[model samples]
Target: MTLLTPPGVYTPQADTALLAEALRDEAVPPGAQVLDVGTGTGALALAAARRGARVTAVDISWLAVLTARLNARLAGLPVRVVRGNLLAPVAGQAYDLILSNPPYVPARAATPPRHGAARAWDAGHDGRLFVRRICREAPRLLRPGGVLLLVHSALSGPEASLRELRSAGLKAAVAARGFIPFGPVLRARRAWLDAQGLIEETETTEELVVIRAERPV
Candidate 1:
C-alpha cells in the first residue's frame, strides 16, 4: 500500500483509500482487464492487479507515470503504466473495470493547471471537467457488463455524473460515500468554495463518493 510519490506526483490520500475500499467490494475475476485513469502512484492499479486482474495505469504527468511505474515494479505488480491524457493511451482497449480518482476540486482558475502538483486536483470552476469526460468516455471503453468505479468530491455534482452516465446508456449510481476533513488543498480554497455556494460557511468536512456504473449486458 505504500507508494513513491515524488514532488510533483500525487500522493495516495483519503480519496485513494476510499477508492481502494470500493475496488475490494467488486468481483474482479483473474485476468480481467482493468484500467486506472489518472493513476498517480499506481495504487489503484496495483490494488486491482492484486485481485488477479490485468491492469493498465495512465496519467498525464510524467512524474506521475514514472512514479506509478516504479511503484508497480517495486510492488511486483503487472501494471502497465503509461503517460498520456485520460484514457487516450489506452484507446481501442476494452476493459471489464475502469477506475479513476481524477481532479474534481473546483478552483479559481478558468482551466486546470497544465503542470505542477496541483494538476492532480485543481479542476476548473465547477470541478466537473474530468468527471464529465469520464462519464462520457467510460461507456465506450467498457465491455458489456463492464463496470466503472469513479471517486470524487460530492461538491463536484454526483447527480450530474449519474445523469451523464445514464444518458450514455449505462446504469450508474453512487455506491459508496464518506466524509473526510478538509485537506490542505480544500482548506486553502474554503473561502472560494463558500462564496460559490459549493459548501456551507465554516464547513470543514467534504463528502466523497464512489460512483459505480455498469454497461448493460
Candidate 2:
C-alpha cells in the first residue's frame, strides 16, 4: 500500500526492485517514446522520464493511475498516466520501448487480500490473465524493431508466455527473476500447493521472471 493514499482503489504491491534491477543500465534520449504497462506506482515510468524518454504509463485501476500521476509530480517527472485495462487505452500508438509488470496469478481458487492493495496484486485464476493479454497486444503497440519488457510470475508458466509472444510473432527472452511471498489473490495457491506437497513451506523464491520480447522491423 502507498504510504499515504486517497480513498480509492490502489495497486501498491509491485516489486519495484524488479524494474530497478532490470533497468539499472538503461538510458534513453530526450525524445524516445516509452510505454509502461501496469505501471502501479509509476516508478519505472518516472525513471524512464528522468532518462529523457517521453513516458506513457497505463494501469487498470483509477487509483493506481492517480497515484502514478501524483508520484510523477512528486518526483518532478513528466509522465502521462492513463486509466484503462492493458493496452486498451493506448492502441494505435506505437512505442520504441514498452515496459510492463503484469498480474500473472491465475484466476482459480485465489483468495482476496485483507490488505487494501490486494486488488492490484492478484491476476486471474491462472495468473496469466494480464500476462497473456499483454504479450499478445504488446507487439501491436511496439514500433517496428521496438522492445517489449514484461515482468511477471514465472509460476504462470514462463514458456507459455514466450509462446504467446512468439505466436504474436515477436522474439523473446528471459530477462530476470526474483521472489515474492504470498499476497492477495494468489494467497490461496500456496496453501493449496502445500496441501498437495508440491512446495515446501520453507521455500524462499517463486521464480518471478521478467521476459523481454521485441518486434522486428
Highest lDDT against the true fold, candidate: 1
In candidate 1, residue 147 scores what lDDT?
A: 98
lDDT by residue (tens digit), candidate 1, 108-139? 99799998878989889999999989999888
**Model 2 ranges off by over 4 Å:** 1-14, 107-116, 180-188, 194-202
RMSD to the true structure for each prediction, in A, is: 0.8, 3.5
Candidates in order, TM-scores: namely: 0.98, 0.83
* TM-score, predicted candidate 1 vs. hidden true structure: 0.98
The models' CA-based lDDT, in order, is 0.92, 0.75
Clashes of 2: 10
Highest TM-score: give the candidate number.
Answer: 1
